[model samples]
Target: MSTSTAPARRSTALPASPIRLTVGGILRSEWIKLRSLRSTVWAYAVVFALQVAIGLLVVSVTVSNTGETFRGGPGANIPELATLGATAGVIFGQLVVSVLGVLVISGEYSTGQIRSSFAAVPKRLPVLWAKLAVFGVTTFVVSLVSILIAFFVTYPILSNANITADLWDPNVFLKLVGAAGYLALSGMLALGIGAILRSTAGGIAAALGLLLVVPIVFGLIPADWSATISDWLPGNAGTAIYQSSRIFEWWQGLLIMLGWIAVAIAAAATLMRRRDA
Candidate 1:
């Protein structure tokens, strides 16, 4: 039978489009990476505990020793005092945050996971931005919560000493927010350092040295320029965001800290783009 079979219909389906990378997707991926690490959990836990414990300790000591808290002389700025007590732990908590920040990126480099990350996102800068956003937001939220809890926990202690602050007061609330912002910003700065160094130990040491040792070294120098430079350092300037500073106002301090963070991140981004994974 030589019957001509009907020509098979030509397939008309279009090729499947490749999955596109997105900011949302990158952020989610970074979140997964951050939460998946055990160190993140432990580090955050320590931050929370330290904030609450130190707040309590400071307030308790203040009450027990003097039976009252005073800011200048007789009149105590209640809100300021409360803010101080709430943020007392940031000094210690910052060390942990700095280490965790360095670990976040350096761990990826150490374990060779950064290769996979870069492979997925060839541009690479998005990964750094995503990490910074996810980590920064998470840190700010956790820090704010911890600071609030510390405030509440120490409220009674402060109240007993006739030191009570209105949480609704803008001065008090803003200071708390500023404290959390400082932590987030500090961590982001450390993350940038980690990215640039690509070594956890070295990044942590450098970050900590810039934050702790450099300030001390500058302070010890017998020169006016050194004192001026020390005042403008990341650690010293950042503290002004939440605490009082004679040299810079709160907004000025925030701008200065942001400048430092921006410089760091810019360096990190440049290196990340130029260097191989």
Candidate 2:
């Protein structure tokens, strides 16, 4: 009996076949989880609708009172203005996306669903990478569609106001795409923060504080110091990607933004490895 029990224990201790954690499988799992959440669909829908409606309203008002519009700035840079029209709502929409991203990770923790995930994958980082990949791709595609629709809706209204713009203009297109990418990246960053913190409130606070509040608090400092540090803030750098005439060069701004994301993800990974969950 002792000998038979020993062999059974040894067999149980041996590892089973490993799953290689392929990207395709991970992506499929992420998509299913993402779509199943009712809040995600509603939040994104509201964001897109708000962006389009506000754009049309702005354009209509500008067309109706061309005199009032000129006070904001010159309208001749049609491309830049048009990009702003399409994405002005991103300033707030990103917060919605960020919260959604946070829940993508935190909700699992909240519900103890992550234990099942880990049991299935065993390799934790693969799950993280898969989630990031899925979130980035889905967010980018959705944002692209939202911006394009906003552009088309606004263009006609602006035209009615006697403003002409080319949607295909390089700068215009860059701004549109950049805005979409920015939203995607912001969501991923928030997800990483959530993974690190493992609490919805904590993650949201940290993400929002870094992206929004810190920039403002730092901005109050004297210009020279503020100018140097402010450029590196997550929101400032990420949003700079959309600026046709950026405060920092595009590459520099992008690097600063990516740096923030890298640090957050690294911290999250470290916690994941060290913690019980």
Candidate 3:
């Protein structure tokens, strides 16, 4: 009777919940992967250096070439001039950012890391989205910081030459932010290309061709339609974000650039889902 009354006690412990995959966790993991790469560090460093160096060179040249800064009526354009000097480096910086964007994803492909990445996140697309978000934000921050530093660093030189402009000027501030935004979008475009090609060299070439070479080729065509097409291209349209353009307004430029990025990423996501790691 005692033995029967002592019938085995049931365990009260509940089964542990399985760990769930989340966008936040994926983003954190992608960030860790990005920062862990030496190439990422160096590539970002080069971008920063180029932004500052090229800015300094441009402002210095402007001061030296012009002999003296404009005063009175001519000084009306000082803010534009200042913004131009601060952002001139983006032309070169975009190239570096593009290469870095390619390497970020394609490097993983080159090694066997992508297989592990896909295995962990069987749904795959989250990985691409996470990578794009992390890399885009990092690039924008770095580019903006470098541009601001360049602005301040060259401010003294510009002031000495009587080319002073207020940093807080609405027009000037927007241009600076726009320049950084352009770099971010450009890099994301390249990242999408990298994901599609899964080859670093080919992605870099394709990205740069879209940004640099294609515009030149279009310009050399000597037709009105060619010129119009060139104006609508990502590279040409993007510049209107930071620099005044006859072809498109800044907002229009932003939309055009976003359109290109969206197309690239859409194509990339489609291919990535169908293909093996």
- Candidate 2 has an lDDT of 0.81
Order candidates by lDDT, high to low: 1, 3, 2
What TM-score would every model get versus the actual structure? 0.93, 0.88, 0.92
lDDT by candidate, in order shown: 0.91, 0.81, 0.90
TM-score of 2: 0.88
Q: For candidate 1, lDDT tens digit of each residue in 24-122?
A: 999999999999999999999999999999999997887688753353346666678877789999998888898999999999999999999999889
Q: Which digits, one per residue and each the tens of the lDDT, describe model 2 over residues 1-277?
A: 3545334565558797576667688779888998899988987897798778877776666556766464334536766666667887788878888888898999999999999988877878888988889888888888889988999977766655555567777878888888888888899999999999899889889888887889888888878888778877778878778775457776666777788889889999888877887
How good is model 3 by TM-score? 0.92
Report clashes for each candidate as comma-separated counts: 0, 1, 0
What are the runs in model 2 whose C-alpha is more than 4 Å off?
Answer: 4-21, 63-75
| RMSD after Cα superposition, model 1 | 5.6
Candidate 3 on 1-277: residue-level lDDT in tens?
A: 3547654555435465567788899999999999998999998899899999999999888778876434315526767777767898999999999999999899989998999999999999999999999999999999999999989988887887777778898888999999999999999999999999999889999999998899999999999999999999998999999998888999999999999999999999999999977
Clashes of 3: 0
RMSD of 3: 5.7
| Candidate 2 or 1, higher lDDT | 1
Question: lDDT at 54 for candidate 3?
Answer: 91
